[model samples]
Target: MDSYICQFPGCFKQYKNRCNLKRHEEAFHTENKKFQCVHCKKILSSKQNLKEHEFIHTNQTPYVCREPGCGLRFRHGSQHSAHKRIHVAIKNIVNRSSVVSFKLSNIEEDIEEEINPKDMMDFTLPLIKRSQDYILPVI
Candidate 1:
């Protein structure tokens, strides 16, 4: 039988066939959905879902902001050109209904101000480091 390769980008692990991919997803990703979201405390069925869920943490919106008192928001600013608006006020921040937020201590600024790309970029990262050296296995 031809080797079944996991098609997910960066997942080089090959299986006996395509069925193995399903098994891998079930065992390592889907089976243990024990880790819960800290803010909304939602259950995650897989790492991909967990990663996507993190966008809520930053209140990211990829769609055109069309409501009144809105400018525009997109997962990528490139989509801004596709947006058409008539009556929305200039928006300083993108509004996402499901995002979780908390007040900053001793700061009068609105909590929305905390929705910063600098802070959010870290959470979106897949890995903290890429090292050529590998850790030695314990005896």
Candidate 2:
């Protein structure tokens, strides 16, 4: 099989197909951003990127978690997936038998900030709290 390597300096990306190589160059190397956001007028490289960017102005969060009592919505699938892990960790903690193990040394810093529930009345986003901060039932 023939490989198409990108000629861009410092970019050693290789593709099996010729069209894929061209797409990579157009998307990353070239400044030919033809697609523009209708609301913000921000130029994007591709149609998909432009559509995703437009969601910010439209306030359309297509990715929603169906977890009971938590209907949090996100603009991206990655954000929604990360949010779902919180629910999984909470459930594991409650059950006690199925705790997910991880190295504490690997953690760099806390990604969440302490927030009062009363202050979050206007927002749909959940109040992220540390595991130790929660008052779990005595098991």
* RMSD (CA, Å), each prediction: 23.2, 14.8
Candidate 1 achieves a global lDDT of 0.55
Candidate-wise lDDT, in order: 0.55, 0.75
**Residue-wise lDDT of candidate 2 within 1-139, one digit each (tens)?**
8999999999999987897688678878999989987777788887766776788898899989999889999986658988999999988776653232232222423523555578778777657675543335534
- Report the number of the highest-TM-score candidate: 2
Candidate 2, backbone clash total: 0
Clashing pairs in 1: 62-75
Best of the candidates, lDDT: 2
The lowest-lDDT stretch of 10 consecutive residues in candidate 2 is 97-106
Model 2, C-alpha of 32: deviation from truth (Å): 5.6
Kindly list the per-residue Cα lDDT of model 1 for residues 1-139, writing each as its tens digit: 7887766667777776676577556545555665577778987765545655666797876556666666567653324544543332222122221121212232436555767768876776467566533222222
Question: Which parts of model 1 are misplaced by more than 4 Å?
Answer: 1-31, 61-139
Residue 106 C-alpha lDDT in model 2: 29
